[model samples]
Target: MIDFEIPADVAELRDRVRKFVDTEIVPYEKDSRVTAHGPTDELRRELIAKAKAAGLLSVQQRPEGMSHLEQAVIFEAAGWSTLGPVAMNCAAPDEGNMFLLSKVADADQAAEYLDPVVAGTTRSVFAMTEPDGAGSDPSQLSTTAVRDGGTFVINGRKWLITGAVGADTWIIMADVPGEGATLFLCHGDTPGIVIERVMNTMDRNYVEGHCVVRFEDLTLPESSVLGSVGQAFRYAQLRLAPARLTHCMRWLGAASRAQSIAIEHAKTRTSFGKPIGRHQGVGFLLAENEIALQQCRLMIWWACWHLDKGAKARHESSMVKAMVSEELFKVADRCVQVLGGIGISDETPVAAIFTDMRAFRLYDGPTEVHKYAISRQLLRDAAE
Candidate 1:
C-alpha cells in the first residue's frame, strides 16, 4: 500500500529548505548578476558557498539518504526561488546525472566524475537531444561512437543540451552501431568537442542556457563507457522517471510562489471598490490555483512512493509530468492574469515563472509524448 504521509524527518528538512530559500536566496533575486539568463557563474559560486556552509550542497542525496518522496519535498522548497535548486546543488542535468552516476558509475569513475559534482565544484551536461534527431525519440539518435581497438571515436551534433557553458563533465549518448545505443563520459574540455552556441531562450533561469554542441571525432578510452554497452536506453530510463517527477516537484513550488504573490496583490490592490479579491471572478482564479497545486503535489507523491519501493515508476511519472507541467502552467498563467499588466512585467518573477513553466511542458519528454506513452501502456495492459 502507498502512503502519502510526510515523515517527521522529511517535514523538518522541508522547513529548513523553505527557511533557507526565503532568507538566503530570495534577497538575491533582483541582483543584476541574476540575469534573465539565470545567475552568472560568479553569483552561482557565491550562493553555492552559502549552501555549502549550510550543509545543503549535496547534489544527489544526503548522507542519511532520502526516499524519492522526501526528495520531492526538498526539491519543491528549492524551487521557491529560481535559484534555490542550484543553490542547494540539486538542479537538473546535474541532479539527474548524479542519480545516474550513483546507479551505474564504478568506484573510480565516481571518484573522478561524481565527487566534484556532489561537492558543488563542477556541473555536467546530458547530450542526447539532437537537432534533427533525438528530441522526444531516442531511437532516432544520430550520434555515433565507433570502436577502434582500445578507444572509441565519436561524432555527433547535439542541441538543447543544458549546462553546456562552462560545464566540466558530460554524459554523451550515442549509437554504437552493432552494439545499439551507448553512453560515454568525457571531459568538456576534451579535444574535438565544441559548443556551437547557447540558444537565447525565453526563460533565462537555467544557469547554463540551452546549447547546441558538437563532437567531431572525439575519442574516448574503453573505460569511458558509463555502463554496459547496449544498455543506454535502460540506463536513461533509470534517470528519466525520477527526474521527470522531480521537475514537477520543483515547478510546483514555483507555481505556488506565483499564486501567493497574486493572492497578495488581489488582497491589497483595489479593483472597482475595495480589494479585487472580494470579487468572485478574481477570487476564483486564486481558488483554482490552490486546487491545482494540491493536486500536482498528490500526483508527485504517488509517483515518488513507487520509486521508493524499488518499483519502476515510468507510467506513473509520465502521468505526473504531463499533468503537472500543463496544470502548473495554468496556475502560473492565472497568476499573471490576476495581477494584470504588472504580472507580465519582469518587475515581478511571475512573468518569468510563466515562461519557465511553458518550457517545462516541452522538456523531459513533451506533454503529448507522455500522453501517448501512457495510453499505449493502458491499451497494452488491457489487451493482456
Candidate 2:
C-alpha cells in the first residue's frame, strides 16, 4: 500500500541536480586538481562556484523544508559525478558534521562552526576512528579529554579522519574517565591539533582524502563540550544512521552512472557480427545491475521513510548500508568487465567509479561487522 511516487517538488529538484551534474560537473572529471588524495581545495571551490551560479549548491543546507526522504532523491542525483556531491556541499564528513551540530550545537556554537560548513565556505571532520582504536566498535575509543578547572585537556591520535587537513571544524570523540564517552567541538587550528599525514586511499572522490591527525595537549573551555558528558555515543547514533543511509543514496547514483556508461559502450561496440550488448554475457550483467540498482534505491527510500517518521532506523540503516555497498560494488565491477581494457584505464570514469564503489564497501562500516551486529540484535530479541 506504499506509494512509490516521489512528490512533484522533490522530483523536480532531483532532475535539476541530475542535469547540473551531467552538464556542469561531469566535464571536470579529468581536471588536474583531482589527485590521489582527492580533489584539491581549488577544484572543489570552482565546482562549488558553478553549482552556486546554477542555484544548485548546498540544497541540504537551505531552509526549503526538504525531508530525509527528499534528501535521498537529491543526494543520489549529486552522486552522478563524484564531484557533484562535493559541489553541492553535501559530501561527508561535512554533511554528517552539519547534521550532528544542528541537532546538538547551541545557537552560538552553530553560528560559529556549523554555518560556514553549511554554506560551503569551509569543510568539517568527524574524528572518531583511530589507529588500533574505534572503528566497527566505537566503544574501543581511547582518546582522552581530562577535566582541568574550566577546561578540558585533550590528547589523542586519530587516523582515517576525512578532510582533517583542510577542515575548519572538528567533532572529536574522547573517553572521559568515570564519565564514559563525550563529544567535543573545536576549531581545526586550536593550537594542539596536528595533521600527521594524508593517507593515499583508493577512493579519490572526497574533497580531502582520508588523513591521520593528532591532538596533543589540546585545551578547550567547558563550552567546547557538545551536548552532555557521556552522551557521545547517543549523538553518534543520531549521525551514523542517517549518514550511513545517505552514503548508500550517493553511491547508488555512482553505480547507476557506471551502468549507464557500460550499457552505452555495449550498444556501440560490435563483436561477433553484432553489438556485444545483444549477446548474453554483457546483457545479463547489465540486467543484474539494473535489478541491484533498483533494489538499492528502494532500500534507501524505505530507510529514509522510517527516518522521516521519527524512527532511529539503526537496524534498517545497518542492513541497507551493508547490502547496498556490496551490490553497488558488484555493479561497478560488472561495468568494468564489460568495458574491457578501457574499464581499468582512465579513458572513462568507470575505473574511478569502480575503485570508489570498492572503497564504499569498507567506508562506513565493513559488511561483516554489520552482519555481526544484525545477528546480535536478532539473538537479543529472541532471548526475550
Candidate 3:
C-alpha cells in the first residue's frame, strides 16, 4: 500500500515553518546585505536566531524525528522563500553535509563539524566539482591524495564549490593512487588550501560564493579520511540520492511561490477586456504551472518514500531530479511570462527564482547524466 497523506504531526510542523518563513524570513529578501554570495554571517546569525527562537532551526533533526517524506514537506515550506532554507537551517551543502556527517562521521568528527552546522553557527562545503576534471563525471576525478606514512598530501583545483568562501570545513573528494576515489575532511583554512576566486554567478543566495579553490599539497592525517578509502563514489551516492530529492523539494517551493505571485498578478492586474488572467494565453500558463507543481511534488515524495524504505532509489532519484529540475524551471518560466516585464526585473523574486532554477538542472547531476544513468540501469535489467 502507498500513502501520500501528510500526517497531522508533520502538517503542524510544516505549518510552523511556513509561518516562520512568511513572518521572519521573507522580509529579508530585499536586504542589501543579502548579497549574490548570500547573507553575511551577522545577518545569517540574526535570522537563524529568530528561527531558533521559533523552534524551526534544524527542524530535520528534531527529537521526534523527521522521515524523508516529512522532510520533503517541511523543506518545501522552507523553499517558499530563497532564504527560508538558510533561515530554517535546511539549506544545501550544509543540509546535505549534515546528513553525510551523521551517517559517516565519528562522534568527535560530528561534534567538531556537524554540530556547529546543525546549530547554525558554521558552514561547510562538499568539494567535488573541479575545473577541467570531475564536474558531472566522477571517473574523471584528477585530484590526488598521496599517502605519506600517516598523512596524505592532497593536490588539485576545485571550482564552483558552493559555500567555499566562508566554510569552516570541507568534505574533499580526491583520487587515491590505486584506490579510486576517497573522501577527506579538512579545515577550510588548512595550509596550502587556497581560494583562488569567488565566481560571480547568476544566483547569490549561497552564503559562501561559488569558488575556485586550489589544494596545493594540503595535508591530512589518516584519521581524517571519511568512511573507507576508495569509497567516495558509494558515499556520494548515499548523499546524492536524498540530496537530489531535497533539491527538488526546495526548488518546487520556489516554483510554487512564483506561480502564486503570477496568479495574484493575473487576478488583480488589468488587461484589455478584463484581468490578464482572463486571457486564454495567460490563464493556460497559470494552469500549466499548477499542474507542473503538483507533478513535481508527487515525484519528490515518491522518491523520498523509497529512500525512507531503505532503498537507494538511484534510478528513481535520477528521474525525479532530471524531471523536477526541468519541470520546475518550466513552472518558473511560466510565472515569469505571466508577470511580463516585472518578472525579469528584480522588482520581484521571480527573476531570481528563475535564475536559480536554471542552475538547478546542472547541479546535483546534469539532466543528460541522469538520463544516461537511467538508461544504463534499464539496459542492465533487460539483460538480466
lDDT of 2 by residue, 1-384 (tens): 999998898899899999999999999999989999999988988998998998887788788666888999999999998899999998888888899998999999999999998878889989999898798899999999999999899999999999887788889999988998999989888899999899988899888799999889999999999999999999999999999988998999888899999999999999999999999988999999999999999999999999999999989999999999999999999999999989999999999999988889997789998899889889999999
List per-prediction Cα lDDT, in the order shown. 0.89, 0.91, 0.90
Model 2, residue 114: distance off in Å is 0.4
lDDT of 1 by residue, 46-88 (tens): 9999998887786346677777888888899999998899898
Off by over 4 Å in 1: 1-4
Count of clashes, each model: 0, 0, 1
- Clash tally for model 2: 0
Residue 344 error, candidate 2, Å: 0.7
Candidate 2: misplaced stretches above 4 Å? Answer: none
- What does candidate 3's lDDT look like per residue over 1-384, in tens digits? 877778998899889888889888999999987887767767778889999999889988776777899899999999999899988888888899999999999988888888988999888999999889797888899999999999999999999999887788789999999988999998888898899998888877778669999999999999899999999999998899989998889988889889989999999989897999999999999999899999999989999889889898999999999999999999999999999999999888999999999988887989999999999999999999
Per-model TM-score, in order, reads: 0.98, 0.99, 0.98
Best-fitting candidate, scored by TM-score: 2
Query: RMSD in angstroms, candidate 1?
Result: 1.2
Q: Please list the residue runs of candidate 3 whose C-alpha ends up more than 4 Å from where it truly belongs after superposition.
A: none
